[model samples]
Target: MKLKFFGAAREVGRSCILVEGKSTRILLDAGVKVGEEEAEVPTIPNSMLQSIDAVIITHAHLDHCGYLPHLYSNGFNGPVYALKPTLEIANVMVNDYLKLSNPRDVNKDWQKKMQRKEKTVEYHQEFRVKDLALKLVPAGHILGSSMVEVRLGNERILYTGDINLKTTRLLEPAYTEYLKADTLITESTYGGDKDTWPPEKDVLSGLMKSIKTTLDNEGKVIVPSFAVGRAQEVLFILDDYMRSGTIPKVPIFVDGMIGKVNRIYRHNVIFCKDELQKRILMSEDDPFKSSNFVMIEGKADRSKVLKHQGAAIIVTTSGMLKGGPVIKYLERMGSDSLNKLLLVGYQAVGTPGRELQDGAKEITLDGKKIKMGIKVETFHLSAHADRPQLLRLAGRIQGLKNIFIVHGEERKMMELAAALGKHYKVTVPVLDAEYTT
Candidate 1:
């Protein structure tokens, strides 16, 4: 067996890896980075790529599965395997990726070509295509997130796409027991010396406090969140707090992809915790359709939402404050001292959200200085594991001979690499690096 670091090596964007063994070549997660206008993808020899029997996607996150559409355009023909929800959302997500990347009449044909070649795999069900055996275990990150395990020619390999050990309010924890894999490839998104996460309660308390302060001042609170995992988690938290009377009920407006995504969440509620699904199916119970939430849609509808009076909570997308409705919300609410901006996800470098996290008073967004006298707070209610949690996850895997850390900042990966070096013998490979086993 052989492993090669293609993408998500020494960086946290595109996630792709190659496994060659048992007369089969498996390409795990051929994704594209969302940061740059142009991205770099690792290329395989035509001989090797043509022989690839399967393509496995771990989740629906763009960084982990965004580049899949490009693969269909690349002349590689093979079954694309992912969980049911992952497949559904991937179909939804990839179209959005193409539209956002190349939004023109000319690119419409390109999008159709990619969507034609796709397949779905249900959880716990194993399937064989050509020389590869594939199965998916829950990754506990999003609605259809999963950890992939493949068996080939008497060798077993596990690739955790993007895992979260701790279950959020909406999802279950990652399935940790492999029982058989000799080689385990794990995500180190928070793998580092400084990757410390606050406890869940404390994080929630801080989030509520931030919003409460804005509400108290009769100011608006703008929360820039990912429309999927983080947005749902925040909604669930706010819902519970509101029901408990911890926070006063106020007009809550959700913008960007959130409204459409909430429908996806409802349509596939079974993929979540059993009780959440029951809450939806049961009469006189609807957690997502609270009285306070106003799902903002279209430019005209969003403009009406911004003009609302009194205290309100605006949850918008482009989680990093890079673009989307959050920018519009910021342009309006930023200068007000009464308004508050809460960051509920990891802000990438050079992103507006990161600047706010770093206490930058002025930011360039939509060609203007988004000057703010408003308060800004950050909470790490992340979908990735922290340092101790990452180490604990590492402890759970059986007989790990080699560990390759991917999908993290260089320093964080190096920190994890250094820490792992203390107790276990593992190799933290480099960008475009290759090794044989």
Candidate 2:
């Protein structure tokens, strides 16, 4: 078997991996590099594109599955394998990307092409195509996220696709039962030593303090969140705190594509943790539909939110503040000293969120520089595992011959490789580099 690193070898976006066996040529993920005006996709050679047999998606994140439609546009019409919920969520995500990037192709014909291409796979079940056997195990990064395991002949390989072993409010911890692999491909997004996070309670306390301070001063709190996991997590945390009387219950305006994604979350209750699924199964215990959670849709409602004066919390998308309705909310709320912007995820280096997090006094929004007077606080609510957590997960996989670290910055990947190398032969692959096992 031969493996190639096409994207995210020494960067954080555009995660893709190519695995070639004697009878199968599978692309693990063909994603887009986001947080920029022009997103980047994996560099697949034209000669290999048509020969690729399948694409297996690990999750619905844009950086993991956004480029699947582009594959279709390139005349590679093989079946795309993914978890059922991932397929559903990717439909929403890919359609949105198509409408935004390729408006000309956002019609019914394109939709039919996407529909005819997807094949759903159940978790922990083995499926075959030619000489390859593949299975998806739960990866606690997001709903329906998974770690792809492939077996060809006597060799077994596992790809840890954006995993998190620590449990969060939204999902269970990643599965750690399977303990053997000849070659292991892993993500090192937060593998640096400095990427350690504080206890969840402390992080939540600090976030609540910031929100309370803003509200007590009669100012609103604006949160720029990712439409998928981060938005749902922030909502669940805030709702839980409010219900427990730990924080004041204020109106939480759910805007942008978050509501639609949350609906998908509701539809995939089986993918969530047992605790969450039990609550959903109980009577009158819907965690997503709280009294304080107001669904904000249409321009008029958003305009009302921008003009309203009373203290409220606005949860919107484009987590990095690159685009989406969060820009509108920031335009109205950014100049006020009393308001707060709580960042809850990893912001890419060039994004507006990173600029603000780095203490920039002003930011450009919609081509206009806005004074950033609002209180900005960062809470470590990342879905990726930290350095120690990564080591713990790596330790679980027994008999690993080669460990390739990808999906992180150069420094982070090297740091992780050095740490994991102490016990296993580790390789920090360069972009487009190939290795065989």
Q: Which residues of candidate 1, in runs, are more than 4 Å off?
A: 39-49, 103-106
Would you give me the overall lDDT of model 1? 0.79
Model 2 clash pairs are none
* C-alpha lDDT score of every prediction, in listed order: 0.79, 0.87
lDDT of 2 at 67: 79
Residue-wise lDDT of candidate 1 within 184-255, one digit each (tens)? Answer: 777888887878887888888877877787798899988889877889888888878877878889878888
Candidate 2, which ten residues in sequence have the lowest lDDT sum? 102-111
TM-score of each: 0.94, 0.97
Residue 162, model 2: lDDT of 95
Which ten contiguous residues of candidate 1 have the minimum total lDDT? 103-112
Give the distance in Å from residue 108's predicted Cα in candidate 2 to where it truly belongs: 6.3
Best by lDDT: 2
